[model samples]
Target: MPFTQAFINESFRFKTLLPLNLMRSSVENSSILGNFIPKNTRVLANIWAVHNDPKVWLNPQIFNPNRFLTDDGKEVIKIDALIPFSTGKEILKTIPLVKQFK
Candidate 1:
């Protein structure tokens, strides 16, 4: 069941439904990735870019559910970068709802 869930997760990450996150305004001046972000600046995050980032996932372009599996292959490892539907409170409750299990 865990591997199946991992596969579903990888599938979502492989072809993200919504690649762009909701636009957010900076409440205050902040620096991100060494760049200056002024207050009131509209900022949008790219979920696809993060999902495919080399720094975050090894061989990210390849469809590998094992990336979300534990070493023993008995449990699914939660990955913070697998956000196909952008980021929000709902994103925190991400869980595959498939009913079949072997």
Candidate 2:
């Protein structure tokens, strides 16, 4: 998919997918991997790569929002593999805004 207007418009149904997309970009862009690892280091920066890895997701390159949607398409919840914002991060900066429509 070209990821143009139609894809953007349809994204409303898969709100959580937005963060996943961002994380994928972040991981792909970073080069900290294979460079250095200081002793006693606890945090890592390859979260994005991990989320979209082929071993983790089916057809990761394809933008399938339905992957995150419930089988019945009723509700959406964050899956452990899709951690884009990281745990205990600032809520204000990572929270997704829900839009109410009439």
Candidate 3:
């Protein structure tokens, strides 16, 4: 069922349920990728952008479940960029349930 799992993963990435993750406010002055951020600034993770980024995914517009499979097609490779749900410790807990129900 590797392809089945891969299909589910690719489906999650192809059309994310929520494009932007829940906003998080900065607690203190900081910077990201050379961009300065002041305290209390609201930040959102664009799950849609990560899933469709050409730099990380080849022909992202095409929904290819095979992209999530290993060369031997025996396992589903987890892509670091595939964060359809908000990322955190809690997200790790939800993945298995999502797959089970799907």
In order of appearance, the predictions have TM-scores of: 0.77, 0.42, 0.80
Q: What is the C-alpha RMSD of each candidate to the true structure, in Å?
A: 9.4, 12.9, 8.1
Task: After the best TM-score superposition of candidate 1, give how far the Cα of residue 99 lies from its true spot, in angstroms.
Answer: 36
In model 2, what is the error at residue 100, expressed in angstroms? 39
| lDDT (Cα, tens digit) per residue for candidate 1, span 1-102 | 998999999999998887777887778887654567699998666777767778678998899999999999999998766776766644524322100000
Candidate 2: 10-residue stretch with minimal lDDT: 93-102
Pairwise lDDT winner, candidates 1 and 2: 1
lDDT of each model, Cα atoms only? Answer: 0.73, 0.41, 0.75
- Candidate 1: the clashing residue pairs are none
lDDT of 3 by residue, 1-102 (tens): 999999999999899988877877778897554567799987666678777878688999999999999999998898777886776634434333223222
lDDT of 2 by residue, 17-89 (tens): 3333322122232224234434444433344454455665677667776665557655554444554444333
Give the deviation of candidate 1 from the true structure as CA RMSD.
9.4
Question: Candidate 2 — what's its lDDT?
Answer: 0.41
